[model samples]
Target: MGIARQLVHRLEQWFELMGAEYAYMATDRSNEASLRLFTGRCGYSKFRTPSLLVHPVHSHRLRAPRRATVVRLGARDAERLYRSRLAHVEFFPADIGAVLGNALSRGTFLATVGGYEWGGVDRFLACPPASWAVASAWDCGGVFRLQVRGASRLRRAAAAATRALDRAAKWLRVPSVPDFFRPFAGWFVYGLAGSGGRDAAMAAEAVFASIVNMARGRAAAVAVEVAAMDPLRGRIPHWRRLSCTEDLWCMKRLGAGGGGHADGWDWARSAPGQSIFVDPREV
Candidate 1:
C-alpha cells in the first residue's frame, strides 16, 4: 500500500485500540483530494455540514453598520438576560436556567444594554497555581455563549461581544483557543433569524463578524455547530460548502467479546465522556 493508505490504516487501528467506535477526519469543502482520501478510500460516510469561522486578532476589516455598546452584567441583570434568551429561543427554560444560574454562581461576566438584557458571555479566568502546573494536560480554551432576541440586534450585539472577548484575551495574555486549534478546531457561527426580518446578505455578514470576533479573542480556532436547519433563509455564502464529522457511535461488548461475562463492557451504561485540551502556552 502507498504511504497515505498506510497512514489511514494506522489511524483506524490506533482509534480502535483506544476504544473509539467511530472516527472521521474533517477537511475544507474546496479540498477535493482530502475529501476523496477520507471518504472515497476510507470507509467513512458523509455526516453533516459544519461551518468554521475565523478572525485574526490583528485584522478587523469587516465593518458593522451599527456600533454595539457593551457593559458588565449584574447578577439581577444576568437572570433577566437568561429569561430573555429563553423567550426568544426554543430551549428548555429549566435547562437554560440551570446553566445561567451556574455561571452566575461561578462568577460569570455578563454584557447588556440600556437596562434591557440582549445576551451574555461568561468565562472561567482564574485558576489555581496547581491548575497551571499541569495546564499542558488540559484544554484551557474558553467557552462562551451569545444569544440575541432579533437578528439585526443580535448582529450588533455579537459584533460588540466579539470585540469585548478579544479585549479580555489581550488583558489576560492568553492566545484564543480557536486560533491555536485551527484546521482541527473547526469554527463557525450559527444564528436564528426571524423570517422577513433581514436579508440573507446582511444576516450572513453578521454571523461571520460574530465568529471572527470570537476567534480573534485568542482562540486557537472556532467552528459553529448548527443542530438544526433554518427555514427563513437558505445557508449563507461563507457557510455554503462546509462539512462535519460522523455521529459518535458506541456499542456494547457482549460476554467473551473482550473479557468474561462479569467483565463485559456495557456501552449503554457507560458514563458520559469528557475531554480537556489545555493550551501549552499556559504552561
Candidate 2:
C-alpha cells in the first residue's frame, strides 16, 4: 500500500481496537487525491457537505441585532440544550459536554428576541423562545495559528501597507486586509443552530455576530461550519470573500461491517441533517 493509505489503515486499526464502530474524515472537495484515498481505497462514502463560513474581525466592534438579547450559557446548560436540540443531527459527538467545558471553549451562547425574558436557566430550558438560536465558541487561537502561503511579493507588500495605514490613522475605517502573512489567531463558532425560519435565522445571525464581537481584538476572524442545508446558514452573517462552501465530510463503518446501522441508525445512509456539530478538538 502507498504511504497515505497505510497511514489511514493504521489510524482506522487503532480506532477499531479502541472499540470504535465507525470512522469519519473531512477533506477539501478540490483535493482529488484525498477524496480517492478516503472514499475509494478506504471504503468511506460521501456524507455531508458543510460550508466553512468565515468573517474577518473588523477593527471596530460588530453589533448584534438591537432587539435581540444574547445570554451566555453555563457548560451544563449548554450541554443539556445541545443534547435535546441536536440529537437528530448526524455525526453529533457523544462527549459534547467535554467539548463545551474545555478550557479552549470561550462559552456557549444563545440569542432571543420578541419579549423573551431571562428567568433563570431552568426556566429558559423549560420554555425556550419560539424564535431562538444557539452556538458555542471555541478559541482556536489556543490550538494553532494560520498564515497565508504563496502570495506574490506585490500583494504581500500591499497587505503590509494597508495594515500600516490602518494602524497610523484610527479613523480611516479602512477595510484593510487581515494579517494573513503572519500567524494569526481566530475563533470558531460550533454547534450552530436555530429554531427555524426567518425569525429564528435572525436570532442566529445575532448570536453569531455577538460571538464575533466577543472575539474582537483577540482573534483575526470568526468562523463556523454548518451543513449546506442547515436552515440558519443563509442568514448567518459571514463575508463571502472569506468563506468556503466546498468542505466535504465522509464516513464509513469499520471492521467487517459494510456501513451497517450499529447504533440503530446509520448516519452514512441518512439524508442531510439540519446541522452538524463541528468538534473543536478535531479542528
Candidate 3:
C-alpha cells in the first residue's frame, strides 16, 4: 500500500504539472487491495461501474440496425474527431495523438452519417499480462452464437429459458457468469464515443458490427467497455454482460481549485454517478 501511494502520488504530480484537470483509474470490484489503496489512502473516489460485454462477431452482424452507416477511420481522422469533441467526453487524455500511435492498438474506426458527423472506437488486442499466467475465458470476450433455427423444440426451449435467466440476473444488478476459455486472444474495443443524437447512435451499431465481423474471421470474440450513461449502449443489444468482472472507475481531484466539491468527488461515498467516462487504458 505504501509503495502504491508513492507511485500514484508521483504520477499525479507529473500529470498536475502538465495541466490536466483530474486523474483517473479503474479496477475490478473484487480487488479490495487496489480499491483501498486508491480510495482509502490515495484519496481517489470510485465513480462508474463500466461493464465489459462480449459477443461473437456474427452476433454483431445480426443485430446491426438498418439505416446505420459506419466508416473505418484512419489514425489522423480518429485523432481529429477526438480533439473536436473533447468537451463531450469525460476522463479523456489530452495526448490523444500518442494514444492513436500506440503500437498496442490494431486500429481505430469511425461511425458516421451523410459525411456530416463521426464516432470513433479504438481497437486493441487483449494480450496475456504475463507468460506464466494462463489464458482465461474472458480473454476472448466470451463468444456467443445463435443457431436455434434447426434445433429441436426442447433444445430451443432450454436456450430460451437460459437467456431469460441471464436477463433476470442483469436486471437484479448482477452478472451472468461467463464460460472461461484457456489460451484465448481477441479484440477489445475501447474509447467509444458518439454524439449527434440518434443519428450518431444508429451509426455506432454498424461500427460495432464491423468489429464483430472482423473478429469472426479470426475466430475470436470482441469485447467493448462502456459506462451506462453512454447512449450508444442502448443501440447495441447483441453483447452479453460478463458476470466475471465489473470495472470500478475511480477519480481524484488535483489542486485546491474547482467548484461544488473542493476536497474532491467520491462515487463510493454515494450512489453511482449518473455520468461517467473512464478510458480502459487509464485503469
Give per-residue lDDT, candidate 1, residue 3: 83
lDDT of 2 by residue, 1-283 (tens): 9999999999999999999988888888999999988999988989889999998876655657787888898999888888988866766789998898899999989888797997766787788788989999999999899988999999999977876776687578566677787899999999888784788888888999989888878888999998888888877878888899989989887777664865657766567867787788888
Report the lDDT tens digits of candidate 1 across residue range 15-104: 778876555454556677766666676645554443332333323333422322223344455454444433444222334334434421
Off by over 4 Å in 1: 30-32, 53-115, 118-283
Q: Superposing all C-alpha atoms, what RMSD in Å does each candidate have to the true structure?
A: 15.3, 2.3, 12.2
Q: If ranked by lDDT, best first, what sequence of candidates would result?
A: 2, 3, 1
Q: Is candidate 2 or candidate 3 better by TM-score?
A: 2
Off by over 4 Å in 3: 1-23, 29-37, 58-63, 113-180, 237-245, 254-283
lDDT of 3 by residue, 54-136 (tens): 66433223445555554566777667656664535555667766766665455666555543333233221122111100000
Ranking the candidates on TM-score from highest down gives 2, 3, 1
User: How does model 2 score by TM-score?
Assistant: 0.90
For each candidate in the order shown, give its overall lDDT on alpha carbons.
0.36, 0.85, 0.55
* Top candidate when judged by TM-score against the true structure: 2
- Evaluated with lDDT, which candidate comes out highest? 2
Comparing 2 and 3 by lDDT, which wins? 2
